[model samples]
Target: MTENIAESIVEAINLTKTFHPKKMPAVVALNNISLSVRAGELTALVGPDGAGKTTFLRLICGLMDADEGSLRVGGMDVTADEQAVQDILSYMPQKFGLYEDLTIAENMTLYAELHGVPQNVRQERFARLLDMTGLAAFTGRLAGKLSGGMKQKLGLACTLVRSPKLLILDEPTVGVDPLSRRELWEILQTLTKQEHLSVLVSTAYMDEAALCQTVHVLNHGRILASGTPEELRHIADGRCCDIAPTSTMPTRMLQSHLLDDPGITDAVPVCGKVHFITRKAGGGVAFLSKYPELPKATPSEERLEDAFMILLKEDEEKRSSNIQPPSQREGDREAVVGVSKVGREGSIDCNVEGNASADTDEAIVDITVRDLVKNFGDFTAVSHTSFDVHRGEVFGLLGPNGAGKTTTFRMLCGLLPLTSGKLSVAGVDLRTARTEARRNIGYVAQKFSLYSQLTVYENLRFYGGTYGIPARELQQRIREVMEEFDLTDRADHVAGELPGGYKQRLSMAAALIHRPKILFLDEPTSGIDPLARRSFWQQIAHLSAKGTTIIITTHFMDEAEYCDRMMIQDHGEMLVLGSPSEIRERMHMPDADMNAIFIAIVEQARAELAKEGRKPA
Candidate 1:
């Protein structure tokens, strides 16, 4: 191996971390892991929860000390020169240390002064960050009042105030909107090129993985694999394929069935499809022939997640092959149904030419604005905005923080009162039939909404009971949900104790308990691992198969493709609503991801609005 320390900005050698537990022996957080990060490069630290991603970031930032290992930043030892490391590094923790009550400008100024950034430099940097993050007009707005995505951007700006050599971001986009995420990524790209900054960002988003020059896959407190996206993809060994099934069951069934077959290795859900990894050659074709109803086989490119799954499976297989204890020699169990499905709908509303379900040949919607209007203290948050939802959508609602996606959703769920215009669910008006209208709804909030103190089972029970489900009926429903979400073991765990994915799963199950006619999901998949997100969508697909309509709003554009339709709302105005493909077509841009399209749409809309002498948000 080449040891070019002169060019390397971050170097780690045999790094190990351990935590002492009250009742048990010391637990190793990182074990003999070695890696290097270079200047002008973005590195992604990826893995499931409890995978030591946070620990790794902490060690690099000198937030904590390693038990046995060495880490160097800018040729300075992290353990030996703690203050020196802290001085040159910008570490944005997963929970941004922002005072919510502070104004955006105040927050930036606070951090800048602490870092002793020159007044002139601070003003220049603040202006650039505010404009780039689209918070130029909202500098006086309270940080707490900002949307999740905006808050993330402000936190990033605060971190950048000092202009550190190395930037460490931990799950920075966990709960932001897609447009904001795209902007943040663009800013990072600019910083890397202009400042030659080294960025090490930890994320659960696979799409973000593509932006990184190097991706380090960590699991169970150890580095599993590391490489560029292209190099990592080869680990799949040509077994991955985009297998379109006749329906969703085959996807899950195939995932389970493949585990039982010796030739197959692993299967992960992605973009309304299943990515299967199996041994190369004759076995895949022969096994696939067993499911003739599905579309004919076609070799698909391997994604980063696919490679991660393949490596994880191979790791397991290697462990199994070793002479170890029986506890470790495990066989494949029945694939549980609790994981979410892909190609799930984005909103419950779909516009049909004549019939209610006629245009739904595609799943997911682009947008659905139903005379959505809201008011507070005689102030109108939204006016009578009427729009339709198209299929395969990644719609966005843009505004300062309160321009009304939440308000619209609240009314749709009968949580808020609407002043005017018709609000329909699928085809039924909520005013006339709220119960019937909400049968298909799912909703997730920016904050944790489920019972934090209650166990997972108790929370689900509460939801089922509130829906007036009979005990006998509810029990079966609970079992099915638990199985589908892989929450069976977590059934007894406290809701607060569960990881982000499990909490999200419980919240979803609660929303879905009624088996509603349509689903209303608000930011449902934020703040979870890439694998967890894929698994969550798997359940969404399963629900869609039962003909349940889904409506969700999110800030992640990678997720936009899963929707059947989408719409973009800015300053309470419906800017655009169409299929993901149509949205791209409207922008006349190909190969532009959903986030990029959203940016273009908002920028173009703002430009037109400005030319008309109208204030744009």
Candidate 2:
């Protein structure tokens, strides 16, 4: 009931968790962490994997007991009054626990009954949840048939069926498409404001973190830092710069070259540029001057990630510098590494095909498909498709779920046999030179395919060996990647244990182990947080600069901006292709950004089909 409002809904005191591994003696998941979450506020639990974020969520939800200390949800002790807390709170785990066999409506109804919601409220809440989640039109649709984003919405709707006072969401947006993620967030914002709900959401996305009223950064079961995004960024001391490169390869090389140099605190690849944080102003310029090969350097301010990186680095240095405590060096590292910085934020569903007629001569045609057609029994997955991915360019292939993008991607990777037409990669016909084509292309599939049980190093080694990487070269490459990607510390961490961001980085490393001439990424940044996605794109930009052709297919339109060129496929047909500007222009929108253009174009297409009395497929 909205009548009763408590100040502190969730509170924890000196929470601790420990477990022993098979060979290892012990591992502490949470180490003496204490926190308080207030009512009618959205709090973000931000962290990488093994940070005990999930464990903390579970403890507050009464799913488990902490080895030390206590937790209470809505003023009820979670451990002492587990059932009471469960009734008052709703916990949506990272997985969301959707029943695939059930239809959307059935799933909601089932959860409603479980929560003992009154029959009268059940129908009303069900309708509201569906509308909020944009699932009203497809309540009859099987839950298994929904897309990643849609399924997440359905899960959220089910969790909200009973209108619990406290809501705990664990990585709810993982693997969801950009449009779906935005939609979900919109619903969350509305629910929190309208219902005055107290929400504790854990996420990997920094952009989402920025949306919260408060944030707590968890690392190795401890709060590394806690505050609002601005508060945390203030600790950076003004020392980060977004370095837009005139050339991608040189920029990436410059970033890697500076990794061991103490002057550069953190360097990550971003949308077509390398972003770096330094210990002091002009450090980037100074570093670039040392490498005459690099273009004239630019100085900028540190971002949230920059601050996070600086903090992580400070933590590392403190551990290594026996005489120095982390706090002691805080002032020395106090510069907020930035020429001037702020997180780039906006809508996400901005994408479409390009229409730029400008100089096509520079485009290196890596993959050429003409009149491509693929069909399964009684169904055509792809039909009359054509597109070209230029050399050293990030290309995006976008469409809704079941829109044939995956099928097309599979055929391009030579994982599936093409029904007809020509498909060539790196100037070689895939049909005739499958081995050579495969050799020249690196691919990270939608479903993670790495050895989950193995350590990061072991998995990389395994992939490198499989790809025929020379032992010495492989070792060197592995070491370079580990250090450059800041994954050296996680080299021994179990692959499955690595956070979503690290897992993506590891997968990319394995895919590129052989240094393929062309890279194919299928929804590479799907499940991770915005910060991780940005970092991952930085790596991609690095590769693209090296003349490595990149063909990426993603549902995140905002990501399309990083692409030199992109193509949109809908219902097994090529709808558009060109750069972001060109695609926006094609929609006849003046100065509208990608998201607006995308919505306009899709809606226009749908309306046109309706007007023509042609049923849209």
Candidate 3:
């Protein structure tokens, strides 16, 4: 290591890790990677799933020993002095364990005692942590009842009961909402600034990576690039453009079309426009002119994501002679004709001249909820919520964790009963004919719900059989869907053994086997990579254009931009409802990014509730 051992907080020299299964091929979790982290700095390790980020963090924290090479944490040899290294460092894995049955105060006290914190100062430290994490008010509440975001915060607090010299977090905000993510980042920033803490965090979000003082991009167990956000953005400089679609075309449609061009490195729908990067530097203009229907493109500032995608694409191209990049897959281009046909059959008419709730003409409504309410004993999960979703529209439901988004979605999909009010799907009242209504809809749950022990093909076949498709037709449909999802090659692979992207693709494939009119996706892109997300959204765009109604719940705020309309919910109540642009205009923050807008809306809602002499749940 070139860096002084006394000055660097963490250092790794030619480190490698390999995992050997009993009968399977050896998996290289980390290659010969070298890096150094200076004291009192926030260093980020960013990559897609299966990129060895977790392994690196584990090695550094002495949770796992490296197979070869040297590693040091807090100026101690991690492999030789594992306990000593661990004593000075705190590691929070992706799934942090907390005593759910205990109250927040009890959990914090337990962790503090375990860390050997002095009783004299423990009370003061606990008070500060709870206040800083915004959980002081909920100190007496059971940890199990806390929201996902709250649980994450509590986990952080427990880890920090007695501050270690180094803190390592693995995907700390994986499924956290935009507002909660902002809060968590604020806490981390304050610790780094005021306490002079050293943090090594692994994350998949580019936005989070941009916040770090230094970032290392890892892929397939190798360190591909390392630099500051500004330094990395230069890699894609002059190749990025913001494309405004013509009035006749949707932003997603234009984005899908742009990705079809081989020269276009990457394309994503963002803020009512398509942000894309080209393969050649300064070739953005030339790439735009290829499609006359596209509006005049403007040069946009390059982002860290643009550079990250460029680097991944370049690396893929260099490795394979016949690179079947995810962006250029033929399966992604398949037209989803089922969406349009379903939309026409289920379109709803609203009186635009007067009240938005009044129907002016006879039309189909894919999903209808009126005065919907769900209660668990005395606690209300959903409170008199009402909404109408037309066919072929992409409707987004966003909220912080434990905001009842899932409850509403379950009721709409006929998985749960409403406490009161009417619910309908595809013109069939779910309250009256839930079984029949379910036939017209497909649902992909937040977690992987497929049989993990079964192979991909077996799982698809089983789901198809349950839907009552004939044997011959089921086989044919399974083959076609697998081919469309680019999973034909992995047909025999165990579902549980697949990577994050493949697992997601298999989940969607299984859901669409019956070709339902409406599709419900819950955090579909939660843990996947940027490339996989692009491909998944491309398929979504195709379905939407073909007239399929999509209802989704997501934590990624940027994804709200793709929806025709979205609703923000908190504390079992709707806060805002409109298109992304309309929401921005309503909040008087037209130029603000989605994260800022989300935080502002939620905070504003909480303030309004306070003024009304009511707490937000």
Candidate 4:
């Protein structure tokens, strides 16, 4: 409200949007939301999926018309002078269309031409962007051949081919690795500071939002709050604390127990500790006394995410009490085997007795990869990689986009064959007995792979039937799963029509219809909102506690902290392996967060590769 209208880069007054599909009921995507982005400032629209962030972005870019209200961009009426508004702003959508066959340089050239950049200015601009993005060496590499992180950087370079008054990026770092994410932020920050560029970015990551000058929190088509990061942090003042577990209980268990308390607003496991927020302001000490089982609690600095969740909790409380807390779900399922205590190095000691059966007292090593090698002609995707995943352990596989993480996962899941190696999963050799190995594992692909036309219940039934479950049992199981996932209300809804969060839940439920011993998730929380991500991980933690071995790949570095052990790879080679804490200590940056550590490791690997005269693809 204090913004100067004359100096604002973008302004919206009483903006509203609604969509009417062919047969479905009209959906109001945005309610009467009013906000402004000041010139030369970075503004963030922070929200969960289906929160109208994209709708607002599209309206400002003149890609769609608002059903009501008015919007102005660069002091021009967006609806009246749409083209003029567009000419002064660049928009990078969730999926920026870079031709796969085009090289990085060619893609930039194409976008530059489309924007009508003068030929005389093209060379210098291209040089600056390439150098800034660290893609100068890969200018001739086809976009299709570039790694996921590289492709994102290229997409950004293309978008910046012609400097505009404002830049709008929608979830630009959805699947980008930690290193690339940091690089992209650096570029944007440089542009904003030196060129006086105005940017409006919609993001799911709270840390990214914290970097913005102003953040607008949206949910259910409404703006929950808007303020600077510090101002937002004040919302949770004196309410946040770190609760350390007294015993060896998993952090997830402590988190679940804390969340069950009505006074608690939110609780999440972070760095082997539970960082929790309470509803009562200035009640940290009193709250600690209520949980005597927990070790001495200490006040912690509030983060933007804490404030965001506090706002969301307040909103939810005002709305209704019908929604159940996530912790209200059924007790954890029993694990197939027991796990060993954490070692001095903070690594889980898997008491592995070779090839133990389900009835045996000794624990079994669920997955074993020894001397694994995968080849595509002269290129190696995985080289002599060896690791063991114990039953019920949360094992994380991390790397930059083209680091062969996916290829390694494919071979382990029996989806891809290894050129030469020994691979065993669930006591079955993946190379020689793929069917048996696959039967013991469930895989949820990165993308939604369920039938879009089928209803949620139908999809569940189909998956159960595919696993050859009895019709009667399958029906009951589907109902139970639907209820557990909070999908019972959406049972009749088509899978494709569901929100991103619901689609993810349905996918996981379908995959678990047969209750496989191991679950494989690839970037499961990529584009979801923070709250949805918390719920998703809670389910994962519950499943792991119940004795389900979980193997996952994710670009969100923060999620890595939850894993018992993790393996970091680059260019088909393992660079580091250990618990999150151990890896941080090895890097000798105890205070550095996961993102910093990940960037450091990848950079070190690339440096070694350059020394070896090997350029990463």
Best by TM-score: 4
Query: 1-617 in candidate 1: lDDT tens per residue?
Result: 23366777899899988887443456677878888887778989888876788998899887788888789998899978889988989989989889898999999999998898999798788888888788899999999878777888899999999889999999988766666677789989989998899999999787788799888988767788888888888776567666653434444444444444566655553444555666763345556667677676567777787787666656656757764311101221222323223222322333322112433445343234455677676667776777654332223333324456777767866678678776765666777787766655556665679998888889989989987899999999999778766689878878876666778878877777767666677777666665556566656654554445566777666666665556566666667655455456667775565666777777787799889998733
By TM-score, the candidates rank as 4, 3, 1, 2
RMSD (CA, Å), each prediction = 6.1, 7.3, 3.3, 3.2
RMSD of 2: 7.3
Q: Name the weakest run of 10 consecutive residues (lDDT summed) in model 1.
A: 325-334
Report the C-alpha lDDT of model 4 over 425-500, residue by residue, as the tens digit.
9999987899978888899998999999999989998899988899999999998889879899889888888889
Candidates' lDDT values, in order? 0.70, 0.72, 0.82, 0.84
Model 3: ten consecutive residues of lowest lDDT: 345-354
TM-score for each predicted model, relative to the true structure: 0.78, 0.78, 0.93, 0.93
Q: Higher lDDT: candidate 1 or 4? A: 4
lDDT of model 1 at position 344 = 27
| lDDT, residue 167, model 4 | 97
Model 2 C-alpha lDDT per residue in residues 1-617, reported as the tens digit of each score: 11123577887889999877664458788999988887888889876556788889888877777899888777788778889888888989977788999999999989888888999888788878888888999999999988777888899998998988999999898766555667888888898899999899998666677788778887778888877777787766657666544332333344544553567776664544566777875554455666576555465554566666666667657668765321212221222111011011111112332222334444556788877889987678898787666666666777666667888988888888888999998888988989878988888987678998999899989888988889999999898767666688889889876666778788888888778888889888765545456457656655665567788887666677666666666567666666655566567664554555555655566677789997634
Those runs of model 4 whose alpha carbons end farther than 4 Å from true positions after fitting are: 284-293, 333-361, 608-617
Indicate the residue-level lDDT of 294 in model 2. 54
Clashing pairs in 4: 335-547
Better of 1 and 2 by lDDT: 2
Which one wins on lDDT? 4
